[model samples]
Target chain A: MFTDCSSSTTSRLIHLYNRNGVFLPRPSVSQFSLRTTASTWRCTLSIRSSSSPSAIVIDGKAEAKKIRDDIKIEVSRMKESIGVVPAEDSSEEEVLKYVSGFNDDPSVHGVLVQLPLPSHMDEQNILNAVSIEKDVDGFHPLNIGRLAMRGREPLFVPCTPKGCIELLHRYNIEFKGKRAVVIGRSNIVGMPAALLLQKEDATVSIIHSRTMNPEELTRQADILISAVGKPNMVRGSWIKPGAVLIDVGIKPVEDPSAAGGERLVGDICYVEASKIASAITPVPGGVGPMTIAMLISNTLTSAKRIHNFQ
Target chain B: MFTDCSSSTTSRLIHLYNRNGVFLPRPSVSQFSLRTTASTWRCTLSIRSSSSPSAIVIDGKAEAKKIRDDIKIEVSRMKESIGVVPAEDSSEEEVLKYVSGFNDDPSVHGVLVQLPLPSHMDEQNILNAVSIEKDVDGFHPLNIGRLAMRGREPLFVPCTPKGCIELLHRYNIEFKGKRAVVIGRSNIVGMPAALLLQKEDATVSIIHSRTMNPEELTRQADILISAVGKPNMVRGSWIKPGAVLIDVGIKPVEDPSAAGGERLVGDICYVEASKIASAITPVPGGVGPMTIAMLISNTLTSAKRIHNFQ
Candidate 1:
């Protein structure tokens, strides 16, 4: 019964992790079979041995599906009871004007402005214009500041980092008093991931382009998160003996035999890391699926808050 | 001539570093003698040997005096040409109304709401009410979020952490690729200090109350910042040899022979740290003086920006 529900949830939306790390949905009957049968979604496990790789693969697809199932029920209940549904809109009009329109609209629960605005547009100014209350994307500076601060809570957390933390929570990984290292310091992923880890009472060190020795820090982490967007940058040797690894980076590398002449890879060298790590998440079906799930979750939360729904 | 000018600058304001780490001015003629000859303000250096403490003392008092002198000239020039001066007001009225009044006033360049409000008032709500443009204290979440983001700049940085960074810059200390550890996570000092260090390309690790082994992390830092308010909590053995130390924590310790039966001490055991560190800042004369200087500097910046005075 559980398997049937999860598979149905996963097949409802086909998510593609684009180069910009945004997940776009495509509804297709043909892609359904490919998703179930693909090695990407398989939860592979092996017994620990010197000859064979052995690490518990975290099934992010199933985990995200489970979360979505719970959110689906809550959203349904919210809509049925309050007659309110979350709304979103994308427009090419003057950025500030469009943002302000959505900000003032009573019906709009959440507002997200797609990134990489035209070269002529000032990205910071456009983002700053989004009303903090309706900023479901959680990119607003005020939201981030509150997230970084102790005793303060952000209305919403950025989807990808929130997904990473959710995965850990689902797995029951202990964060308190643990040393965690995050590679890359991009505002969206690495930086927020580090902040979240620190908030959970884990001591966090951020490694970046300017870091002199990343391996030294990585070796000390009980939990390691890498979001540098480099293919297989973290080697097997970089893993602590039993560290839980969360790789947010997904990059395409050419593979002639693979579908579309390419395959996805994470910052971690998975085949080698599997031999040493206690648990790991695969590149294609890992953080990518969870990111989309978090977007839906945030939208639901915004709607609930807006309508004062329980 | 330089000495005479510095003494005059120092004497103009009789500043005290109060319990809350805020500098309060108590104008008085009698305080002048205590200001100059007091051991608190004196910069003491000893020869390097087994028998003597060797670290070069960072004279924050002299540096702050120099910075204030420069700001004074600029403020005078702006006032003469534009007929505008920075204005500040503290009121006991309702917080939001008072904040909005200052936010709308054309002549008010900066707004600072003293912290630790009455029990009935929400602190975050009051801080958030201050206009970001006039937030001279830099406590707003939006400013902090901007400070943490790459390629983004905050209009104002909190005075204490800004002072810490300015002191490093003035002394020509390097940040890029260095390992820095901040020993606190307060919204005001330690958190922002860590963010500022990371912004300068330093790999930063924050050690807090829940950190399993703070000394282990502190020993690895090339630059160490201790802002936890525990007096002499960081021992000399916790420091890496020849590291640059910035001690922002100041607490009053009992001293029978001292005035008011108390003397200020920093997080670091200065007597022991001076022997191991390459350079160190003394508590009362260090970050305290620079904090007030940054407040003046930030106000000057706000005035110049408001009036378009270069």
Candidate 2:
């Protein structure tokens, strides 16, 4: 699901137990310890290919990388124009640094932290700790609440959901007065995605796993989206002919023949769905890039507001 | 729709203006005319009745009033025991009086401001002004954002959505691994409702007006909940035979021959849906009351936390 990267330094581990009247565990390599060396370690998890025929690829991975590149460029521009810079560190210290740095900076606008962060971190606590003014991800409770309630607009929208709407807009898909079915109920994707689609004047319905007969329900959708992580769960027969399908699931299943012993897949069976659906996104390229692109967009928006930039 | 409570009390108008400066035209409405006496005003809207009916009443209005009465009683008991009162000031004078009267009293743990304030008001700024600790409605952006993100729970939840789940729980509706369809995408009822349904381990999908064929999609729901405000928009044929229907729409349609010249209705066509569906919630008395009751529950929970009485 993710690439693991490790870089090592020559600095020795500091065991500061009982320092400043605080008792803490000593820094020692144990069974649970992460292996490290002076250089760097990078491993790309490959997806397994199914025996099934070829399917349409929704390339989210490539899109996410492109967005990251874009952000890197904009970040450089900010540093060039002013002394201000977005956090280079992805730690709590980096969060604090940006929080205090953006206090009065006229050059920085929005701030964002990538989602699906490491399991040890609490997303809300970290989001709350970030300056609300720069919370470009809109994952903060305040932003979400504002998005949910009327009369308040979110400073930032969750990236995946934003990407979903953006795709519809890009593809010139008509949503007004049309019946839409959104599969999955994740807050970051399904919930906000439905809200955005509804805002666009679509009569929206949310269908989840609890739905008794999903295939029957999905067959009615003119526009269908699946964000749940179950690979190949939505079949071609599930979609109505000429229906627009957006698959948000990205997973790696085992494949012994592939280069990496695995291959990527989407929530919908791209092969079968593409034949029946009018428009479908490819796995790996479709929605993957939009999240980070939206992140950059949100960050720039936040920075613009903070700096009062035209 | 809302009633016109316009009055001739200049001072009172001024008071409202001062209290909600964000939405009011002027910081002080002392310069405008106001009504000195309160008058009865009612909603004016109508919906077509079903030819033959079968839906059971969900009864939101009765439930809300009952919950309010319970709150009033509890408020009295709290005041008698701890010499503190909940904030109820809608005017400058009352605000001053309450602030002075409750100086530093920590006994009042939760403060909830009932929603749907007069049309001449700013809901967002007013709700924002509530103390974070006493924001029982969870309408605040901070609270909403937390609710949207994974692993972050809001201290409070919006009342109606909570009530919907409460009914499901009370009735022992099996939600786990079931497919649920939630119609509408409103902030209060639709968006949060989908999230709550998903949190209960059901696969969820959201549909709205843009949906091309809602009837076809709806027939697949094991559980169907409609929060769309349209009167009797959902028909009997649109539902699955055994699907559970939770209608959140409460509209008062024009009924010239009826008492008060109006009749209450729901999003679903009651009679037809009830006959076709296994169970359905009626308008007026259904989800409406649960909102207020949940508000009370949130308040009590907040109070217990504040007083360490739980």
Quantify all predictions' global Cα lDDT against the true fold: 0.74, 0.63
- Worst 10-residue stretch by lDDT in candidate 1 chain A? A1-10
Candidate 1, residue A3: the lDDT equals 18
- What ranges in model 1 sit over 4 Å off? A1-52, A87-102, A105-133, B1-51, B87-102, B105-134
lDDT by residue for model 2 (B1-310), tens: 2232222221111111232222222222112111111110111122323344344444556656766787788777777777655444465445434434333456654455555544554566566565665555766666666666667887777888889988777667788866678877667787788778877867666666445556655776778888876555676667888788999877665554569966666777665577677666767767877876886677666655555542
Model 1 alpha-carbon miss at residue A122, Å:
20
lDDT of 1: 0.74
Chain A TM-scores, per candidate, are: 0.74, 0.68
Instruction: Report, for all candidates in order, the number of backbone clashes.
Output: 0, 99
A1-310 per-residue lDDT for model 1 (tens digits): 0111112111211233432332222222212111011222221111122355577788889999998899989977976898766433334346588678779988876676444465667778877888876775887777888899888888788989999999999999999989999988888898889889999989999998878758788989899999976555676767899999999978665444467956677777676678788889988888888998887888677667767788
Which candidate number maximizes lDDT? Answer: 1
Please give the DockQ score of every candidate, comma-separated. 0.63, 0.39
Among these predictions, the greatest DockQ belongs to: 1
